[model samples]
Target: MGNALRFLYGGFFKPQSDEPDSLGPHGVTISTVGVSALAHDLSQFDITSQVPQGLSQHVVSSKKAQTKPPPKTPEDAAKLITQTLKNHEKADVEVHTGHLAFYGLPLPHTLVEVETSSTPAYQPQHWKFELHTLPVDAKAVADGDGITVYVDARHRTESANVPREVHESAIRRSKARAVKNYAEADALQKNIVDAGYRVINGPNNDDILVRKYRIRLRGIDAPESEMPFGKQAKEELVKLVQGKSLKVCIYDEDHYNRSVGDVYCNGTFVQEFMLKKGLAWHYVAHDQRPEFALWEKEARAARVGLWASSNPEKPWEWRKNRRNGV
Candidate 1:
């Protein structure tokens, strides 16, 4: 260890010999601690020699300090964001806040959103997406007790590998999207086949329903986010499940990979709750359930919830009109 310590000392290494074969040092020496000489000296001893007892474990300093990583390119940023999302359990990631700055791509993403699963909150907690790892050139700011990240987006091409969940996010993002708009990523394409269901703690103590993946309450259609009662409907859904856990009967996945199924709290059908309150409509075109349509009728006759409107439009019609610029 003493020899090793001496070998590591600055004065040990001399400049290399010009002869290359000569063990003797050569070259115009400045400091006696040149690296080439140390190598030559150390080679004479047993290469596997152990460190002496009580030798300091502190790292010897290098002449040059390490350089910081290059500023993250939009491509690099996108990849990092995707990998970050992919590595975690979907339920664990939380994107509360952030913003992305597009770099070289001519994407409509000038206003693109990255969405994931939502953990419905009633009291408005200050936590959004709490990414386990931080991205480059981005800083996390303390915002109202939560964090808001700002990223500089700079990429030349759309990385096909990134998941849609990270890039073209939908309005109802999962917990993966607890984000405020700082970066992007892509979701893995997983095919579903009656994997089964699960229940978890939502923002409150309620039993939030889940399958192997996110589920869209089947046999019914709620207002689109832009529809008149859309915001209210979402708030209402959040409230309904606020202090409740759910029992889900998952049927299948929509074309978008979301689960479409029935939800029951205690013994009460959640879809029925939504309809009775006029928060949703029976989606007759895709539904196979018999009782759902019956509930819609009752809500309609009562003139309660949305049915109170003299001529309330079904949710699907509202969506079609919006797509057609109605």
Candidate 2:
């Protein structure tokens, strides 16, 4: 007959004190016992003789063993659980003691939740956008920030309309100095022009002054000094402003050192008038005046100054094309 020896890891296993002893059924007796082969309940918890480097095998297991989960160390796991709670819709899981579990075993390895309250942080940087109106150089310099943004152009602000006498006095004062050979008179005339006003000289120096308001001729793109319409443009401007009163609004100067403004005579904008006369074309590139396009249409229709040419290019386009050698 063949003999078999079996060891009983009991209900109370003294892992440390009770050294490995051969087993009998009663009172820790050493004997040969027949191996009872019923399917050894493989599902129930069992204590193994194996122990980790720092831990002891005296560790206990119970029916409640399945209830107490092993410790979790992954920081990501905790974060994910927090996020899950934040986004929890149905509230299927409950938090017990800081450990999160669905049912009993830890949730599927992939399940992650996000915190709704904490959003990603972001910082916007300084950037450039187009403006409807050219920016004032002084403000641009002071702001020290990037250029002012505009949809198409800068919004024009309303201005006060000075009386004809005020303009006349300015011009007469300048002329009197010019007649006296005092340089102040010449300087006065220059100031008036720079301020978008003009002084008209009379026959006997006791002349009527016609000041055109809001005329930024210094910045307008007229024909070059020697160009056919350059002199005409100046003459035309003098004629327009000399006898007429206009509603003028001033604006900032551009890189070309041109002061841009809106000049109106009898509520008719002088820019529109000039565009129709073909004496000037649109001077802007990125930020264009509102009337730029409309005046272009009018000029095209009337075959005004530049439109007389078969394919007269706009000044901005011409300059750009010249730069690109196209």
Candidate 3:
């Protein structure tokens, strides 16, 4: 009776399978169902206890998260964005606030040309897209801080028509500035546009003298009507000094028996004004007044009067060409 009770108990507890079971001394062969049964039976096992003994540290991500964008102009902001993106090549930095997108690179040099945004949002604003002019060196100089830009003597003296003395004066002033002589430099720079010398003509029949004097513009060759803008130039000179009494200081005389000197009106250089108006060009025959070149340059930039054309023939060249019929 005892033997029969043991046999019945073993049969009831044994796993049931069609194949006979084979067990190794150190391992157990488990069927898919048996493994599932074992796992279900071990639901209370501690999963944390199964990790390898030497590797259990928590991982911390190295990525930096961005929350706000620095304030800047759309152009500047784009620069910052480009730098920011390049810096985070291996990761992402999200800029969730005030991020504006714009097109074009607008720095490090002059933007000679540009086109405005055609997008519907910007159309109503009538934005100024064209930069037809800038504060050119011959006419204006921007300040260092750029807070208050000082206009150069461009209004009356274009680069192409600036006087030689004026350029020498500017060089002296620039030298002063180089040495940090701020006050002297400022004074010298201001004097560049001031009338350099005076002009005087032969005395009138009356001892009192017809006027202060008659003076000839020292360096430039005013255009004659035969040349481009020649008539306009003569007309311009007539308007500036014809009836007006001028302060003349004659330094020399030209081959034409005319006094060669700088003419001033109320202490303002009259030829300087003419050059600024592009009424004449820097003459190389009598004297190559490169200083006046800047005055001409400024006029060209402004495209005023004679400089309005892309290529206005110089008076000398025009005369030579006319003679040669080339």
Kindly give the stretch of ten consecutive residues in candidate 2 with the minimal lDDT sum. Answer: 1-10
Off by over 4 Å in 1: 1-212
Q: Is candidate 2 or candidate 3 better by lDDT?
A: 3
Best by lDDT: 3
The clash count of every prediction, one per candidate, is 33, 12, 24
Tell me the TM-score of each prediction against the true structure: 0.36, 0.32, 0.35
Ranking by TM-score: 1, 3, 2
What tens digits encode model 1's per-residue C-alpha lDDT throughout 288-321? 4434554576588788777888887777787688
Model 2, CA-based lDDT: 0.38
**Preferred candidate (lDDT higher): 1 or 3:** 3
In candidate 3, stretches whose alpha carbon ends up further than 4 angstroms from where it belongs are 1-215, 288-290
Report lDDT (CA) for all predictions.
0.39, 0.38, 0.40
Q: Which of the two, 1 or 2, has more TM-score?
A: 1
- Compose the digit string of candidate 2's lDDT tens values, residues 1-326: 00000111121111223443332211222211111110021111123322112111212344343354432322332333333333443222322212332212123232332221121111113111111232122222111011111111112221234445456557567667657955666666676656544455444664333323212432235554344555566566555544443343444555644334455444454565566677776665433533354445557767877677867655545556768997
- Per-residue CA lDDT of model 3 for 1-326, tens digit only, reads 12221221122112345654422111223233433332332232223323222111211123243322242222333344333322333233233111211111122112111111111111113322211111122111111100111112332323445477766666676568668998986676556434532111223521110111113466676776666777677666555444343444445655654445554544456556777788777665665433355456557768988788888877667778888998
